[model samples]
Target: MTIRIGKIGYLNVLPIYHPLETGEIANDFSIVSGPPSALNQLMDAGRLDVSAASSIEYARHPDKYLLLPDIAIGSRGPVQSVLLLSRGPVDSLHGETIVVSAQTHTSAALLRVLLAEWKIRTNFVTGDATAILSRGERPQAILCIGDEALNLRFHPDYPVRTDLGEAWRTLTGMPFIFGVWIARRDSLDRSGQAVRRACDTLIRAKVWGQTNIASMCALAAERSCLSREELRSYFDGLVYDLGEAEKQGMTRFYRHLAEHGIIEDVPSLNFLA
Candidate 1:
């Protein structure tokens, strides 16, 4: 059986997918690339059998998916690719407006949660974040993630930017899981063994990539036009696996989501072996 795999095409994940690029894994599968949100749509639509999706996607629709054990895009603190850029301090957000990136549901919801918990009553304006550079929008703060976050990094003009993961830690004292590799329940039922094997392969790839950071940085530099040093900095700050801390954080996050009406219900967090 052929499996359709959806991946996020970003520099931060280039290393984890090295096996696929080097043919260490089978090429019989269909591969499609998009931002995490689009990949989630593909999986929900049955267009993809498995995908590396926004972790919150699986949390949002748990019955429909199975998390591949031992793997994820997570960070203990300071994820360089997800940032909250503000014109002023977060405490001064009482009557300000914030713009949110249109690419992700999880980050946007998380932003709202953090803002609400912090008692920052700001009106959020959602739109294409990339356009913020081209259009002079009316926003005191902006929530940007993924490639957009990478773009906004080190801009001398944006002096008050905070990493969202870091912000979460300061607010809730927990790590954040951004994305996970998940198999559709129906697809897993049809090809369980292959799915397991693929998950193992990807997990191994993640480990191997971590061990060979220099080479992975080189690959990322060539592909994404990011410097090796910058890519390394990004990888160094993020965790590549799903461990106990992430599980607990995810549980807390799901409860918050359910309480705040972001998701309809909360489901048990179970991993596929």
Candidate 2:
């Protein structure tokens, strides 16, 4: 039987699954890829057995899922893939519009927290970029994530960019976790060892990808239509594995979620062995 695994199809996560994509893992697993929010929706609806969901999703539904330790899509500094493109500076954001993409859950919340702390009040609009850009005036900043963020770099139409992950770190002095793998607790109990093996496979794949980044970048370039050098830069600048800093950031994020009543309680950072 093939184990169904839903993964985020973004470049930041490319390195983590490089080994699996290259057939280095012997396990019988089917990889389905999608955006973080979509994957979380699938996991919530039981359409997927396991998925790399946004950490906020896992925190929201802690009893239903188990976090896979030592593995995540994180960035200690500038995460090129998750960015907020602004037309003007932060100080000028007041009263100006900020368009938020529908593909995000954590970044939106994080932005709100930062804006509150920084005392930068602005009208937050949730809609499509095309619709927002169609107006006579565009938002002061447009929040973009996943492939859209990467694609924005090539367009040069958006002049200013702010890496949301980096911004959070600048404000809070902590790393940011955007995504994590979570197994259904019921299914995990039935096949605990298999779940652990899959998690191990992901960890090993990440290490191998980091060690052999050139080859990984080659594969990514072919897939993304980006040059090897450009692709390599994306891999080089990202932080793939979850460490202590990310754990602290995740805790803080969960606390914020709890404060907003998005979640009833803060989930312990529990991971399957």
Candidate 3:
């Protein structure tokens, strides 16, 4: 049986996708590409066998999915892309309406955790953050993630730019895990060998991307409309490996989500053996 995979269609995730899209690796996997939230929903519906899912999804449904070994899209601090664009002072957002991006999962929760910490309560609404970026004087705050957050064309009208990654690190003194690659346990359970092969292929692709960063950066810059220098730095900034530190961060994040009542409880991470 052929395994289907869903890839995130954001520039921040380009390095892991380069090898597959460019046909550098040979595989029989069918591809479904979309934004992070779409991919997460597809996985939830069992439409995709494997996917790059928001870390929060795994935390939310730990029993339904098994994490692939040693792969993540996380950051130590200041993920320039996940920005909280606020029209007023972030601390003064009491009673204001803050619009969460439809494309976000982890970021939306992260925002709530941060606000709870700051004792800043605001009414949350969901909307197309991309469309709202074009407007001014409405939606007092916007949580922009992925490629949309990478754009800095917003006017001075929305000047309060708060980086969620940086804020999380400052608040907890730990790195933040944004997304992770996950496979439905039943899918991998049915084909262990095939699953391992696919996992290795993606790991190799990540290695190839690190070695051939110039090509990756050029392609990413074209798609993101960011300068080569900026793309280079951004790619360099991301940590694609699920190391011990990232796990610790994930645990801390789960605790925060629970403490803030964003999630029911802290879910234990169960990885594929």
Model 1 lDDT on a 0 to 1 scale: 0.81
Every model's Cα RMSD, please?
1.8, 2.4, 1.5
Instruction: For candidate 1, write residues 1-273 as lDDT tens digits.
Output: 767888787776777776676776545667789988899899999899888998788987888998988788878889988888877788887888788877787888888778778877888777776676667654677788986788776665567888889888877798888888898988888899877777777788788778888888887777665788988888898888788888888888888888888888877987786
Cα RMSD of predicted structure 1: 1.8
lDDT of 3 at 89: 82
Total clashes for model 1: 0
Task: Estimate, for each residue in 17-87, the C-alpha lDDT of model 2 and write its tens digit.
Answer: 76687687555778988877788898998777677888889888888988887888878878787777887
Which is superior by TM-score, 1 or 3?
A: 3
Per-model TM-score on C-alpha atoms: 0.93, 0.90, 0.95
> For model 1, what is the alpha-carbon lDDT of residue 259?
83
User: Cα lDDT for residue 250, model 1?
Assistant: 82
lDDT of each: 0.81, 0.78, 0.84
Better of 1 and 3 by lDDT: 3
**lDDT, candidate 3, 83-161, per-residue tens:** 9888788987898988888888999999988899899888989888767655643677888888878885264667899
Point out where model 1 deviates above 4 Å: 136-138, 223-225
